[model samples]
Target: MRLRHITGSEDFVADSPYVVHRSERYRGVWNRELFPKPQPIHLEIGMGKGQFITQLAVLHPERNYVGIERYDTVLMKALRKRESAEAAGCRLENLRYLSLDARLLPEHFAENEVSKLYLNFSDPWPKARQANRRLTSQVFLDCYTKFLRKDGTLEFKTDNTGLFDYSLESIPAAGWTLLAVSRDLHRDPVLNEGNVMTEYEEKFSARGNPICKLIAAPPK
Candidate 1:
Protein backbone atom coordinates (compact mmCIF):
# COMPACT_ATOMS: atom_id res chain seq x y z
CA MET A 1 0.00 0.00 0.00
CA ARG A 2 1.39 3.37 -1.05
CA LEU A 3 1.09 5.79 1.85
CA ARG A 4 0.23 9.38 1.07
CA HIS A 5 2.68 11.73 2.65
CA ILE A 6 1.12 14.26 4.96
CA THR A 7 2.51 17.79 5.09
CA GLY A 8 4.15 18.79 8.41
CA SER A 9 3.67 15.30 9.83
CA GLU A 10 7.29 15.17 10.89
CA ASP A 11 7.04 18.60 12.48
CA PHE A 12 3.90 17.55 14.28
CA VAL A 13 5.60 14.52 15.77
CA ALA A 14 8.56 16.60 16.81
CA ASP A 15 6.29 18.94 18.76
CA SER A 16 4.12 16.22 20.30
CA PRO A 17 5.10 15.23 23.85
CA TYR A 18 3.59 11.80 23.29
CA VAL A 19 6.31 10.96 20.74
CA VAL A 20 9.83 10.11 21.77
CA HIS A 21 11.60 12.36 19.27
CA ARG A 22 15.13 11.43 20.32
CA SER A 23 14.46 7.79 21.08
CA GLU A 24 18.05 6.62 20.63
CA ARG A 25 19.23 8.88 23.43
CA TYR A 26 16.85 7.27 25.90
CA ARG A 27 17.99 3.68 25.06
CA GLY A 28 18.22 2.04 28.49
CA VAL A 29 16.39 4.71 30.48
CA TRP A 30 12.99 4.69 28.78
CA ASN A 31 11.06 3.13 31.62
CA ARG A 32 12.58 5.33 34.28
CA GLU A 33 12.51 8.61 32.38
CA LEU A 34 9.42 8.37 30.20
CA PHE A 35 6.66 6.93 32.30
CA PRO A 36 5.58 8.36 35.66
CA LYS A 37 7.17 5.39 37.41
CA PRO A 38 9.24 2.38 36.49
CA GLN A 39 6.99 -0.36 35.22
CA PRO A 40 6.95 -3.31 32.85
CA ILE A 41 7.15 -1.97 29.32
CA HIS A 42 5.08 -3.44 26.48
CA LEU A 43 6.01 -2.61 22.91
CA GLU A 44 3.92 -2.84 19.76
CA ILE A 45 5.72 -2.87 16.44
CA GLY A 46 3.93 -1.41 13.41
CA MET A 47 1.26 0.18 15.61
CA GLY A 48 -0.99 1.57 12.88
CA LYS A 49 -3.31 4.41 13.98
CA GLY A 50 -2.63 3.55 17.68
CA GLN A 51 -5.90 1.74 18.33
CA PHE A 52 -4.56 -1.43 19.93
CA ILE A 53 -1.66 0.03 21.90
CA THR A 54 -3.53 3.05 23.14
CA GLN A 55 -6.52 0.98 24.18
CA LEU A 56 -4.29 -1.61 25.78
CA ALA A 57 -2.43 1.07 27.71
CA VAL A 58 -5.71 2.49 28.92
CA LEU A 59 -6.90 -0.93 29.99
CA HIS A 60 -3.67 -1.80 31.80
CA PRO A 61 -2.47 1.33 33.54
CA GLU A 62 0.20 -0.49 35.48
CA ARG A 63 2.16 -1.26 32.32
CA ASN A 64 3.86 1.24 30.01
CA TYR A 65 3.22 1.07 26.24
CA VAL A 66 5.46 2.14 23.40
CA GLY A 67 4.33 2.07 19.79
CA ILE A 68 6.79 1.97 16.93
CA GLU A 69 5.84 3.01 13.41
CA ARG A 70 8.16 3.75 10.51
CA TYR A 71 6.01 5.89 8.30
CA ASP A 72 5.56 9.54 9.16
CA THR A 73 2.08 9.70 7.68
CA VAL A 74 0.82 6.67 9.57
CA LEU A 75 2.47 7.75 12.78
CA MET A 76 0.86 11.12 12.40
CA LYS A 77 -2.52 9.49 12.12
CA ALA A 78 -1.90 7.52 15.30
CA LEU A 79 -0.87 10.71 17.07
CA ARG A 80 -4.07 12.35 15.95
CA LYS A 81 -6.10 9.46 17.28
CA ARG A 82 -4.34 9.77 20.61
CA GLU A 83 -5.08 13.50 20.70
CA SER A 84 -8.72 12.75 19.98
CA ALA A 85 -8.85 10.39 22.90
CA GLU A 86 -7.28 12.97 25.15
CA ALA A 87 -9.82 15.48 23.94
CA ALA A 88 -12.55 13.10 25.04
CA GLY A 89 -11.14 13.04 28.60
CA CYS A 90 -8.95 9.94 28.40
CA ARG A 91 -5.76 9.99 30.43
CA LEU A 92 -3.04 8.28 28.35
CA GLU A 93 -0.15 8.78 30.75
CA ASN A 94 1.23 5.28 30.26
CA LEU A 95 1.41 5.44 26.45
CA ARG A 96 4.03 6.86 24.09
CA TYR A 97 5.09 6.60 20.43
CA LEU A 98 8.37 6.14 18.63
CA SER A 99 8.95 6.91 14.99
CA LEU A 100 11.68 4.47 14.08
CA ASP A 101 12.46 1.35 12.11
CA ALA A 102 11.94 -2.01 13.81
CA ARG A 103 15.45 -3.17 12.89
CA LEU A 104 16.86 -0.52 15.24
CA LEU A 105 14.96 -1.82 18.28
CA PRO A 106 18.10 -3.19 19.96
CA GLU A 107 19.77 0.21 19.61
CA HIS A 108 16.90 1.95 21.40
CA PHE A 109 16.33 -0.56 24.18
CA ALA A 110 18.64 -2.37 26.57
CA GLU A 111 18.63 -6.11 27.16
CA ASN A 112 15.55 -7.26 29.08
CA GLU A 113 14.01 -3.82 28.79
CA VAL A 114 10.79 -4.98 27.21
CA SER A 115 8.47 -7.34 29.04
CA LYS A 116 6.05 -8.00 26.18
CA LEU A 117 5.96 -7.46 22.43
CA TYR A 118 2.95 -7.19 20.18
CA LEU A 119 2.74 -7.69 16.41
CA ASN A 120 -0.63 -7.07 14.85
CA PHE A 121 -1.42 -7.57 11.17
CA SER A 122 2.14 -7.01 10.03
CA ASP A 123 2.94 -6.96 6.35
CA PRO A 124 3.29 -10.45 4.90
CA TRP A 125 6.53 -10.53 3.00
CA PRO A 126 5.09 -13.55 1.17
CA LYS A 127 7.74 -14.35 -1.41
CA ALA A 128 10.36 -16.85 -0.29
CA ARG A 129 13.14 -14.42 -1.15
CA GLN A 130 11.56 -11.81 1.14
CA ALA A 131 11.07 -14.17 4.06
CA ASN A 132 13.90 -12.48 5.95
CA ARG A 133 11.84 -9.29 6.07
CA ARG A 134 8.94 -10.97 7.85
CA LEU A 135 8.53 -9.70 11.43
CA THR A 136 8.40 -13.30 12.73
CA SER A 137 11.48 -14.40 10.78
CA GLN A 138 14.36 -15.95 12.67
CA VAL A 139 16.49 -12.84 12.23
CA PHE A 140 13.87 -10.59 13.84
CA LEU A 141 13.10 -13.15 16.53
CA ASP A 142 16.75 -13.12 17.55
CA CYS A 143 16.61 -9.35 17.79
CA TYR A 144 13.43 -9.55 19.86
CA THR A 145 15.10 -11.92 22.31
CA LYS A 146 17.76 -9.35 23.13
CA PHE A 147 15.38 -6.81 24.65
CA LEU A 148 12.58 -9.14 25.74
CA ARG A 149 13.14 -10.34 29.31
CA LYS A 150 13.42 -14.01 30.20
CA ASP A 151 9.90 -15.49 30.10
CA GLY A 152 8.70 -12.38 28.28
CA THR A 153 6.00 -13.13 25.71
CA LEU A 154 5.61 -12.13 22.08
CA GLU A 155 2.00 -12.09 20.91
CA PHE A 156 1.22 -11.98 17.20
CA LYS A 157 -2.01 -11.70 15.27
CA THR A 158 -2.58 -11.63 11.55
CA ASP A 159 -5.19 -12.39 8.91
CA ASN A 160 -2.66 -13.81 6.42
CA THR A 161 -2.62 -17.60 6.50
CA GLY A 162 0.77 -17.79 4.81
CA LEU A 163 2.38 -15.51 7.38
CA PHE A 164 0.69 -17.40 10.19
CA ASP A 165 2.07 -20.72 8.93
CA TYR A 166 5.50 -19.21 8.47
CA SER A 167 5.44 -17.76 12.02
CA LEU A 168 4.46 -21.14 13.51
CA GLU A 169 7.55 -22.63 11.87
CA SER A 170 9.94 -19.68 12.37
CA ILE A 171 9.22 -19.09 16.08
CA PRO A 172 10.19 -22.55 17.35
CA ALA A 173 13.06 -22.70 14.88
CA ALA A 174 14.48 -19.66 16.66
CA GLY A 175 14.34 -21.68 19.93
CA TRP A 176 11.32 -19.88 21.36
CA THR A 177 8.57 -21.88 23.08
CA LEU A 178 5.10 -21.61 21.63
CA LEU A 179 2.84 -21.28 24.65
CA ALA A 180 -0.41 -20.89 22.71
CA VAL A 181 -1.55 -21.07 19.09
CA SER A 182 -4.89 -20.17 17.63
CA ARG A 183 -5.73 -20.60 13.95
CA ASP A 184 -8.94 -18.69 14.51
CA LEU A 185 -8.35 -16.23 17.32
CA HIS A 186 -11.86 -14.86 17.70
CA ARG A 187 -13.28 -18.33 18.06
CA ASP A 188 -10.72 -19.37 20.65
CA PRO A 189 -12.46 -18.98 23.99
CA VAL A 190 -9.28 -18.52 25.99
CA LEU A 191 -7.07 -16.52 23.63
CA ASN A 192 -9.87 -14.23 22.54
CA GLU A 193 -10.39 -12.97 26.07
CA GLY A 194 -8.98 -9.47 26.64
CA ASN A 195 -8.00 -9.26 22.96
CA VAL A 196 -7.87 -5.63 21.85
CA MET A 197 -8.79 -5.17 18.21
CA THR A 198 -6.61 -3.14 15.91
CA GLU A 199 -8.15 -1.21 13.04
CA TYR A 200 -7.14 -3.92 10.61
CA GLU A 201 -8.42 -6.66 12.88
CA GLU A 202 -11.84 -5.04 13.19
CA LYS A 203 -12.14 -4.52 9.43
CA PHE A 204 -10.95 -7.97 8.39
CA SER A 205 -12.89 -9.81 11.10
CA ALA A 206 -16.03 -7.97 10.06
CA ARG A 207 -15.49 -9.38 6.57
CA GLY A 208 -15.43 -12.90 8.04
CA ASN A 209 -11.67 -13.34 7.93
CA PRO A 210 -10.32 -15.68 10.58
CA ILE A 211 -7.60 -14.03 12.65
CA CYS A 212 -4.60 -16.20 13.47
CA LYS A 213 -2.76 -15.58 16.74
CA LEU A 214 0.14 -17.00 18.72
CA ILE A 215 2.07 -16.42 21.93
CA ALA A 216 5.74 -17.40 22.22
CA ALA A 217 8.35 -16.95 24.92
CA PRO A 218 12.13 -17.10 24.86
CA PRO A 219 13.63 -20.44 25.91
CA LYS A 220 14.58 -20.42 29.58
Candidate 2:
Protein backbone atom coordinates (compact mmCIF):
# COMPACT_ATOMS: atom_id res chain seq x y z
CA MET A 1 0.00 0.00 0.00
CA ARG A 2 1.25 3.44 -0.94
CA LEU A 3 1.48 5.78 2.02
CA ARG A 4 -0.20 9.14 1.65
CA HIS A 5 2.59 11.59 2.35
CA ILE A 6 1.47 14.55 4.41
CA THR A 7 3.02 17.88 3.51
CA GLY A 8 5.87 19.08 5.80
CA SER A 9 5.81 15.99 7.98
CA GLU A 10 9.56 15.79 7.61
CA ASP A 11 10.12 19.23 9.13
CA PHE A 12 7.76 18.43 11.99
CA VAL A 13 9.69 15.37 13.21
CA ALA A 14 13.05 17.05 12.70
CA ASP A 15 12.15 19.72 15.24
CA SER A 16 10.56 17.45 17.84
CA PRO A 17 12.43 16.66 21.07
CA TYR A 18 10.43 13.46 21.47
CA VAL A 19 12.03 12.00 18.36
CA VAL A 20 15.43 10.31 18.61
CA HIS A 21 17.46 11.58 15.66
CA ARG A 22 20.48 9.54 14.53
CA SER A 23 19.22 6.75 16.77
CA GLU A 24 21.96 4.36 15.63
CA ARG A 25 24.41 6.21 17.88
CA TYR A 26 22.46 5.14 20.94
CA ARG A 27 22.80 1.43 20.21
CA GLY A 28 23.68 -0.73 23.23
CA VAL A 29 23.28 2.22 25.63
CA TRP A 30 19.68 3.37 25.42
CA ASN A 31 19.32 3.76 29.19
CA ARG A 32 22.64 5.58 29.47
CA GLU A 33 21.65 8.13 26.84
CA LEU A 34 17.94 8.28 25.96
CA PHE A 35 16.32 7.63 29.32
CA PRO A 36 16.81 9.21 32.77
CA LYS A 37 18.05 6.02 34.43
CA PRO A 38 18.33 2.28 33.84
CA GLN A 39 14.99 0.51 33.86
CA PRO A 40 13.07 -2.18 32.02
CA ILE A 41 12.59 -1.16 28.38
CA HIS A 42 9.36 -1.83 26.47
CA LEU A 43 9.15 -1.20 22.76
CA GLU A 44 6.32 -1.13 20.22
CA ILE A 45 6.86 -1.66 16.51
CA GLY A 46 4.68 0.09 13.91
CA MET A 47 3.23 2.54 16.44
CA GLY A 48 0.43 4.05 14.33
CA LYS A 49 -0.43 7.60 15.44
CA GLY A 50 1.19 6.63 18.81
CA GLN A 51 -1.93 5.64 20.73
CA PHE A 52 -0.88 2.31 22.32
CA ILE A 53 2.71 2.86 23.36
CA THR A 54 2.14 6.42 24.51
CA GLN A 55 -0.60 5.24 26.88
CA LEU A 56 1.64 2.41 28.05
CA ALA A 57 4.35 4.91 28.90
CA VAL A 58 1.86 7.01 30.86
CA LEU A 59 0.30 3.99 32.55
CA HIS A 60 3.65 2.55 33.62
CA PRO A 61 6.15 5.22 34.57
CA GLU A 62 8.52 2.68 36.11
CA ARG A 63 9.38 1.28 32.67
CA ASN A 64 10.92 3.06 29.69
CA TYR A 65 8.94 2.96 26.41
CA VAL A 66 9.91 3.50 22.80
CA GLY A 67 7.67 3.64 19.75
CA ILE A 68 9.12 3.02 16.29
CA GLU A 69 7.66 3.96 12.94
CA ARG A 70 9.45 4.08 9.59
CA TYR A 71 7.31 6.58 7.76
CA ASP A 72 7.98 10.24 8.51
CA THR A 73 4.35 11.13 7.84
CA VAL A 74 3.10 8.56 10.34
CA LEU A 75 5.80 9.46 12.83
CA MET A 76 4.81 13.11 12.54
CA LYS A 77 1.25 12.26 13.52
CA ALA A 78 2.55 10.36 16.52
CA LEU A 79 4.64 13.36 17.51
CA ARG A 80 1.58 15.58 17.39
CA LYS A 81 -0.30 13.04 19.50
CA ARG A 82 2.49 13.22 22.06
CA GLU A 83 2.11 16.99 22.23
CA SER A 84 -1.63 16.71 22.82
CA ALA A 85 -1.09 14.02 25.44
CA GLU A 86 1.44 16.20 27.22
CA ALA A 87 -0.91 19.18 27.11
CA ALA A 88 -3.42 17.05 28.99
CA GLY A 89 -0.89 16.63 31.82
CA CYS A 90 0.58 13.29 30.92
CA ARG A 91 4.08 12.80 32.34
CA LEU A 92 5.98 11.36 29.37
CA GLU A 93 9.56 11.75 30.50
CA ASN A 94 10.07 8.00 30.07
CA LEU A 95 8.69 7.88 26.51
CA ARG A 96 10.56 8.29 23.23
CA TYR A 97 9.85 7.75 19.52
CA LEU A 98 12.08 6.48 16.73
CA SER A 99 11.56 6.73 13.00
CA LEU A 100 13.29 3.63 11.74
CA ASP A 101 12.53 0.38 9.97
CA ALA A 102 12.11 -2.81 11.96
CA ARG A 103 15.14 -4.29 10.19
CA LEU A 104 17.29 -1.61 11.82
CA LEU A 105 16.16 -2.51 15.34
CA PRO A 106 19.51 -4.03 16.28
CA GLU A 107 21.30 -0.86 15.19
CA HIS A 108 19.64 1.16 17.98
CA PHE A 109 19.12 -1.45 20.69
CA ALA A 110 21.60 -3.81 22.34
CA GLU A 111 21.11 -7.54 22.71
CA ASN A 112 18.65 -8.45 25.46
CA GLU A 113 17.83 -4.79 26.02
CA VAL A 114 14.06 -5.01 25.51
CA SER A 115 11.93 -6.50 28.28
CA LYS A 116 8.63 -6.37 26.38
CA LEU A 117 7.82 -5.99 22.68
CA TYR A 118 4.53 -5.18 20.97
CA LEU A 119 3.38 -5.75 17.40
CA ASN A 120 -0.10 -4.31 17.00
CA PHE A 121 -2.00 -4.81 13.75
CA SER A 122 1.11 -5.20 11.62
CA ASP A 123 0.80 -5.96 7.92
CA PRO A 124 0.06 -9.66 7.54
CA TRP A 125 1.56 -9.87 4.04
CA PRO A 126 -0.97 -12.61 3.30
CA LYS A 127 0.62 -13.78 0.08
CA ALA A 128 2.64 -16.95 0.53
CA ARG A 129 5.58 -15.32 -1.23
CA GLN A 130 5.50 -12.52 1.34
CA ALA A 131 5.56 -14.72 4.43
CA ASN A 132 8.95 -13.42 5.47
CA ARG A 133 7.61 -9.89 5.38
CA ARG A 134 4.97 -10.62 8.02
CA LEU A 135 5.87 -9.33 11.48
CA THR A 136 4.87 -12.66 13.05
CA SER A 137 6.89 -14.73 10.62
CA GLN A 138 9.66 -16.99 11.86
CA VAL A 139 12.25 -14.89 10.04
CA PHE A 140 11.16 -11.79 11.95
CA LEU A 141 11.01 -13.81 15.17
CA ASP A 142 14.68 -14.68 14.76
CA CYS A 143 15.51 -11.04 14.17
CA TYR A 144 13.71 -10.01 17.38
CA THR A 145 15.92 -12.33 19.46
CA LYS A 146 18.85 -10.01 18.79
CA PHE A 147 17.48 -7.35 21.15
CA LEU A 148 14.68 -9.02 23.14
CA ARG A 149 15.61 -10.43 26.56
CA LYS A 150 15.40 -14.19 27.05
CA ASP A 151 12.30 -13.88 29.20
CA GLY A 152 10.93 -10.90 27.33
CA THR A 153 7.44 -11.46 26.01
CA LEU A 154 6.10 -10.36 22.62
CA GLU A 155 2.41 -9.46 22.41
CA PHE A 156 0.71 -9.41 18.99
CA LYS A 157 -2.88 -8.43 18.20
CA THR A 158 -4.55 -8.73 14.82
CA ASP A 159 -7.95 -9.24 13.19
CA ASN A 160 -6.55 -11.68 10.64
CA THR A 161 -7.23 -15.31 11.48
CA GLY A 162 -4.88 -16.75 8.85
CA LEU A 163 -1.98 -14.76 10.22
CA PHE A 164 -2.85 -15.76 13.77
CA ASP A 165 -2.97 -19.44 12.82
CA TYR A 166 0.36 -19.12 11.06
CA SER A 167 1.81 -17.36 14.09
CA LEU A 168 0.68 -20.14 16.42
CA GLU A 169 2.83 -22.55 14.43
CA SER A 170 5.58 -20.04 13.68
CA ILE A 171 6.39 -19.22 17.31
CA PRO A 172 7.24 -22.76 18.40
CA ALA A 173 8.95 -23.56 15.09
CA ALA A 174 11.18 -20.55 15.78
CA GLY A 175 12.03 -22.02 19.20
CA TRP A 176 9.86 -19.62 21.19
CA THR A 177 7.03 -20.43 23.60
CA LEU A 178 3.47 -19.13 23.45
CA LEU A 179 2.47 -17.84 26.85
CA ALA A 180 -1.11 -16.86 26.01
CA VAL A 181 -3.55 -16.85 23.12
CA SER A 182 -6.94 -15.20 22.74
CA ARG A 183 -9.33 -15.39 19.78
CA ASP A 184 -11.67 -12.66 20.95
CA LEU A 185 -9.63 -10.17 22.94
CA HIS A 186 -12.56 -8.03 24.14
CA ARG A 187 -14.39 -11.08 25.43
CA ASP A 188 -11.40 -12.47 27.31
CA PRO A 189 -11.32 -10.80 30.71
CA VAL A 190 -7.87 -12.00 31.69
CA LEU A 191 -6.18 -10.95 28.48
CA ASN A 192 -8.26 -7.84 28.00
CA GLU A 193 -7.41 -6.50 31.46
CA GLY A 194 -5.89 -3.04 31.14
CA ASN A 195 -5.92 -3.33 27.36
CA VAL A 196 -5.36 -0.09 25.48
CA MET A 197 -7.02 0.08 22.08
CA THR A 198 -5.19 1.43 19.07
CA GLU A 199 -6.83 3.77 16.56
CA TYR A 200 -7.23 0.90 14.11
CA GLU A 201 -8.21 -1.61 16.78
CA GLU A 202 -11.22 0.44 17.77
CA LYS A 203 -12.45 0.52 14.18
CA PHE A 204 -11.99 -3.21 13.70
CA SER A 205 -13.72 -4.04 16.99
CA ALA A 206 -16.65 -1.79 16.15
CA ARG A 207 -17.15 -3.76 12.96
CA GLY A 208 -17.47 -6.98 15.00
CA ASN A 209 -14.11 -8.49 14.11
CA PRO A 210 -12.83 -10.95 16.66
CA ILE A 211 -9.38 -9.67 17.49
CA CYS A 212 -6.82 -12.41 17.97
CA LYS A 213 -3.93 -11.95 20.38
CA LEU A 214 -0.90 -14.01 21.26
CA ILE A 215 1.94 -13.56 23.75
CA ALA A 216 5.21 -15.34 23.04
CA ALA A 217 8.65 -15.49 24.60
CA PRO A 218 12.06 -16.37 23.25
CA PRO A 219 14.13 -19.28 24.52
CA LYS A 220 15.43 -19.12 28.08
Model 1, 1-220: lDDT tens digits are 6788899998988888889977888889997788897999999999999999989987898999999999888999999998888899888999999998898999999999999999999999889999999999998999998899997999999999999999999999999999999999999999999889999999999999999999999867
- On lDDT, the candidate that comes out on top is 1
Please give the range of 10 consecutive residues that has the lowest summed lDDT in model 2. Answer: 99-108
Per-candidate clashes, comma-separated: 0, 0
* TM-score, cand. 1: 0.98
- Assess every candidate by TM-score: 0.98, 0.97
Per-residue lDDT for 105 in model 1?
Answer: 96
**Candidate 1: residue 188 Cα off by (Å):** 0.8
Per residue, candidate 2 scores C-alpha lDDT tens digits across 101-170 of 8988988888999999999999989899999998888788988999999989999999999999999999
